[model samples]
Target: MAERKAALNRAPARPELKERLERAKTIVLTEEQMQEQRASFAYGNAPRNSRITKASATSATKRIRLSDPQPVT
Candidate 1:
């Protein structure tokens, strides 16, 4: 009995698109204004960082002092 080789039906690879997708996973922004947003996604989709941590957000959250009535001297 003769053994026949299986044919590989491979498609042409698009390296450029692959590179673009890889780059999208780690979008870098140099502007300070967008630091927070960048940090939020720095880990690619995982919710694990200062920006994603619940304690960091709630503990560091600022409360409005205006909520209290001003003391009239």
Candidate 2:
């Protein structure tokens, strides 16, 4: 379409976008920094009971049944 052709021709003026990409590429993490981040967020340190299985959800219902009181004989 005519609009698509116009947009493609206008794409070369975005120098700020190219600069942002260069800045992002400068933020690479070293091996030691990556290891420290992994150690800090290890699975063993996650909160307990964070996952709920189907069995756990169904088993948590009250064992007793609710009913009205019987009248005196």
Candidate 3:
């Protein structure tokens, strides 16, 4: 219990580490800002003209070897 208490009360060693921690805590976005960020991410995944084809998707998956040496009996 004493060890845990000491660990909890200790401050970050570096000034930059303390500053980063404070910055992270104070980063509060408004609803409009959050919506804009979400929209940017959604569009970033694919351009306006990009399309996914069945062949492209299926090619990404693993395939079983039809000519296996030890075939299932």
Candidate 4:
């Protein structure tokens, strides 16, 4: 408890941090910006060659059957 109290007291709270937090909470994104953000989340930072496509995903699902043993590459 003494160590925890000392750790908590080590950093003094700043009013600027509180103001920044409040300012951050009020931020609003435009529709275009929201669409860009959604696209970013959907297609993250992966290289184009390694990314999965809808057709490829469906074909892969069709290739792997529950009854058949998965082929070892």
Candidate number with greatest lDDT: 4
Q: Supply the global lDDT for candidate 3.
A: 0.52
Task: Please give, for residues 1-73, the per-residue lDDT of candidate 4 as tens digits.
Answer: 8768777755778899999888867666554444455455545544688766544454444443344323333
Off by over 4 Å in 2: 7-12, 30-73
lDDT per residue, candidate 1, 1-73, as tens digits? 1343334446679999999888766754334424444444443454644365533433333331233333333
Between the candidate structures 1 and 2, which one is better when assessed by lDDT? Answer: 2
Q: Please list the residue runs of candidate 4 whose C-alpha ends up more than 4 Å from where it truly belongs after superposition.
A: 1-15, 45-73
Q: Against the unseen true structure, what C-alpha lDDT does each candidate score?
A: 0.47, 0.52, 0.52, 0.56
Query: Which structure is stronger by lDDT: 2 or 3?
Result: 3
Per-prediction TM-score: 0.24, 0.28, 0.36, 0.37
Better of 1 and 3 by lDDT: 3
Worst 10 residues of 1 by lDDT: 57-66
Clashes of each: 0, 0, 0, 0
Range of the 10 consecutive residues with the lowest summed lDDT in candidate 2: 57-66
**Taking the tens digit of each residue's C-alpha lDDT, what string does model 3 give over 1-73?**
8768977876758989889887767666554544455445555554557674334433332232223233222
Candidate 4 residue 29 Cα shift, in angstroms, is 1.1
Please, what's the RMSD in Å of model 1? Answer: 17.0
